[model samples]
Target: MADAPLRSLFQQRFGEAPDLPEILATNPEITRLAARGSCRHFTPDQIDPAILETLCAAALCAPSKSDLQQRDILIVTDPGLLRDLKSLLDAQEWIADAPAMVVFLANNRRQRQLQAWHAQPFPNDHLDAFFNASLDAGIALAFFMIAAEAAGLGCCPISTIRNHLKEVRGLLDLPDHVFPVAGMAVGHPLRAPEISARLPLAKTVHHNQFADITKEEVSAYDTRRLAGADGPGWSEAKAKMYASPQRMDFADVIREIGFKLD
Candidate 1:
């Protein structure tokens, strides 16, 4: 039998059982700490500076591409600055209350400067540099979240920060070849959030090749998701989100930040 917490977490995530390695079923730490729910409500308490520093260090330890270490993190602590950031995000009042805010950046400028200093031929001027830096930042963000959760801190990633990229860049005084990937709000949770359901593993995981998702799978997932919520299901929610164009000019923003997609 699976461990109680693991089984419960599996049910909360997928609304069903999880087939997994036997080791996972028995490991207490993995069963207890592997699941995460986004927390928006936070207490008035502030995160310890030492703890935040340790978490940042742990996050930076995540793998890098060719040892380039292209990820950068900015810890935003100034109340005035945080309020300014919150102002940029419309309707997200929760951000104003969070005790800590950190911005993750994909940094390509370091490598360009390195090439200039070494007088080496800088051949990688295409989309790959942008892709690698963005991916590295994403991985580092994931590591940060894991470390934060393990430390009993709650976090919510604010991707909407991208919507105001120009304003963010100006506010942070970011130079060329550095762009914001995401912002994370960290603090103690006022209340534990409900676990969100996910699409079944079969719909996402493929044996050896890419598998097509049938309408039946989508319908089933929608049904499972709607059982505990009042809003539209995943498919309808996604459709509605995409039906209205969002950040159509993000490409332009990327170009403005000195990243060449081509």
Candidate 2:
């Protein structure tokens, strides 16, 4: 049976009783931890250096493609550099206050260097290499967030860092074939954030074939999300958010950084 906290978290997530698997019901602690929301507001306390290293180690433990280990984590500790990086993100002002910031890089250069060192031909220079590195970095980012949250730290992913890709690459002194995948801000939370509601399993999950989301499902999700909040529903909010083009020129940036999308 799920513990009280796990049950409560499930209720918050689905707006009803949870029908969890036996494994989850038996291990309620993991379920509770996984259910926590992303925290944006953080306190002034700095994350300890040792704990930060441990979190990075945990992140590195994530699976890599063919054990190529194409992901690199750059911990931003320099005050001036951090300030300059924060300036690039005017929309995410809270990043300026984050005690710890990390940049996750998709490093294809390392593998290429390794191939050259072994006198091996680097045949895969196209999109597959780029895709592998990006996917590896993304996996590492997720692991880092999981580890940080488990250690009682708050983490907020900053994908907007891509908007200033060239500036960030210059600031970080990243070479060609080493692209910034994402940034994360970590610190202790000032207050716990509410768990954001997710779509029902029936709407999201599929049996064997892919399923299309119906208008009724979107309407139901919107009603459920706007129960007490004052704003547009999920569909409307996302529509407004994407009404204007965002990061449309990122492809040019990627190509400039030596990634061949073709």
Candidate 3:
């Protein structure tokens, strides 16, 4: 839009910038999706149950580890329950505005139950089961987000579901081997989000072996990202925020959830 070289740079950095003719002729359904990113603000309009089911079906179509199919999705529609969940998850206010919320669970319990029902030994109760369940659930969540966005919905993932692990499980009445991996808030976006900058492909994409990124590469990215209002930019903001000692304590939470992931 500025100059040919700048347009080329835009294409290289992001995928492409639409021309005027393209914008007038093109259907934004797919074109807009290519520029997809997160939206934190959402409209309070309720999403239809039929559309939500379709999104869940699309999510279930995601690839699973060895086709074990251990992931489960739980939809939360009750306002009171949502309030409780919000309080448990550090009261992220955006969540309260979402008309639909989903909890993705890593469900190892079902397999163990099947093994027991079939009168099998079921002795493989080590770390792999837990890891596989979590991995599968995570993949499903990714698919769900993409599918929801394509369906004209916005989604934000809340990992703070891990913060009150026991309370979440108790509230959901979960079994022993099932774990709450992540929560997703879904609704119509109140406003479109600006595309966030990503590091150049050369920094991320490796030809054969893993390529190392240098300080120079990071500096270039910082400059590219900060050309916005109130941006000390992505890298600096992240660095300053995480520079302080942060306590994630994920291991302890997993252990309490009956995952002996040594």
List of clashing residue pairs for candidate 2:
none
Best model number under TM-score: 1
Of the two candidates 1 and 3, the one with more favorable lDDT, higher being better, is: 1
Please provide, for model 2 over 1-262, each residue's C-alpha lDDT reduced to its tens digit, 9 standing for 90 to 100. 4466676776667665456666676584577564878888999998888898999999999999999999999998788998888889868777877888999999999999999999999888899999999999999999999999889999988999988899999999999999889999999999987788877767566789989989998888788878868878989989988898888988898888788898
| Alpha carbon lDDT of each predicted model | 0.88, 0.87, 0.80
TM-score of 1: 0.95
> What is the Å distance of residue 114 in model 1 from its true position?
0.6
Off by over 4 Å in 3: 1-33, 244-248
TM-score of 3: 0.85
**Model 2, residue 106: what's the lDDT?**
97
Clashing pairs in 1: none
Please give, for residues 30-142, the per-residue lDDT of candidate 3 as tens digits.
Answer: 44554677878998799998888899899999999989899999988788887788777655777767788899999988888888899988777778988999999999999
Q: Model 2, residue 208: displacement in angstroms?
A: 1.6
Q: Which residue window of length 10 is worst by lDDT in model 2?
A: 1-10
Query: Which wins on TM-score, candidate 2 or candidate 3?
Result: 2
Model 1 stretches astray by more than 4 angstroms: none
